[model samples]
Target: MEEMSVKTGVFGGTFNPIHIGHLVLANYLCEYGGLDEIWFLVSPQNPFKQNIELLDDNIRLEMVQAAISGYPRFQASDFEFNLPRPSYTVDTLNRLAEAYPEREFTLIIGADNWAAFDRWKSPEEIIRKHAVIVYPRPGYDIQTDVLPPRVKVVNTPLLEISSTFIRQAISEGKDIRYFLHPEVYRIIAEKKLYQK
Candidate 1:
């Protein structure tokens, strides 16, 4: 019998400092999204978020590595690093499909991103080529009726945390123990990341 390809979820993000909210969402997606594994596709540069200050790719990657260390189902992928600049989701998915033929990839995105999905590069191709799992964001509302057949909305725990919030807290000398995994927090503190 031929081996079955694994159903993987492509959880892409900047992960400036991987925190508890990211972990929680990834975990929930793995369980509820019926994904065999969740790969964290760390973006070197996001076109839509270009104005926001970003940390070095290596530093952010290391923190993500530390954050997902113990989770067997979680993986950190630097796939975008080898690709062209201005990392786009469609391009990443296409490359991943060619590179890992044994794994089926699904794009994991927030409700907010889904709202603006049509604006993304090759949005139609993305929907036609792969599946997308949409998770809720505090302010954004997802309209499932208008989405493509491959798109799905799943109920996950509301994690009211953001990397921006954590970075600001660090700058203000506020405690962020509850916001990030201990290992991830340690890396940020040791490196004095986001300190003003």
Candidate 2:
């Protein structure tokens, strides 16, 4: 008998503080996208964004671990931390292939990113290396007809919640506890995070 291959979804983001929206979306993606597991790749650095006021890398990674701790199909990855500065998605995917040769990888992204795919570092190379599954993002247009053979769009829900909003709310002295996982909120409260 042949060995069964595992299909892992690579959902990369700077989860400064993993929240309810991220949790709900990953659950929906796991069920709807036919994924065996979803790895939340916590990037310590994003080339596209300013890192000002961003939480420490380890703290952000810890929040991710706490958020997905109870979910069997969910994982928190600090793989990007080992990569070079300004780690791009393509870099992580390539490194993943080298590190986890047995597991097949799928790149999960948002429709907004799909719209700006061409601007990424070697977008075509990424498509050639792994399957790309894009979930809907509010107000972003994804033209399904022109998608590549390996590129797919799944029916994941739109969770408008964002880490930025939660952080800003906390800074302004609002109790945005409902927007995050209980443990995540607890961790933030204990650390006095984002109190500005």
Candidate 3:
């Protein structure tokens, strides 16, 4: 009999502080989607959103590591750090495919990103090459009627939390203890991060 292949899910983002929303989504995707593992790819820089004050990539990665320590299926990857900018999803997917030929990979994204799929680099090529698993965002709706055949809209619960809101709360001196993991919160408080 042929060896059973591992189904891996790739969840890429800036992950400035890796909050509860990210962890919840990963857990949901792993359990409900039957994924073997979910890798959180931390982007060095996001092409969109110019005004966001991002923490250092290394620091962000560390926070993500601390936040996801208890989850056995969750992993943090820095694949985009050495790649050229602006980091295009298509290129990353291609590289991943080449690097891991035996395992099946799925791109995990939110519905809001899927709505703007046309704007991404080589969108058609990306759709042609890999499987896309899209989860729901707070306000975005998935319209499969217009999407490509390989795209799959997953029924994960929509969590209203966002890194933007978390950062804003921190900058304004509001308590964001509940929004983030306890370890992450402790690190942020100790480091005096996000305070303007």
Question: Tens-digit lDDT track for model 1 on 68-122?
Answer: 9998999999999988788788989999999999999999989999989989999
Cα lDDT tens digits for candidate 3, 167-188: 8899999997999999999989
lDDT (Cα, 0-100) at 38 in candidate 3: 92
TM-score of each predicted structure versus truth? 0.94, 0.96, 0.92
Error of 3 at 2 (Å): 1.5
User: What are the clashing pairs of model 2?
Assistant: none
* RMSD in Å for all candidates: 1.7, 1.4, 1.9
User: Best lDDT goes to which candidate?
Assistant: 2
Task: Show where candidate 1 strays beyond 4 Å.
Answer: 46-52
Candidate order by TM-score, highest to lowest?
A: 2, 1, 3
Candidate 2 ranges beyond 4 A from true positions: 46-50
> Ten consecutive residues with minimal summed lDDT in candidate 2?
44-53
* Residue pairs that clash (backbone atoms under 3 angstroms), model 3: none
The candidate that wins on TM-score is 2
lDDT of 2 by residue, 32-110 (tens): 7889999999988555676787888899999999989999999999998989878888988999999999889999998
- Which lDDT value does model 3 have at 117? 83
Counted clashes in each candidate structure: 0, 0, 0
Candidate achieving higher TM-score, 1 or 3: 1
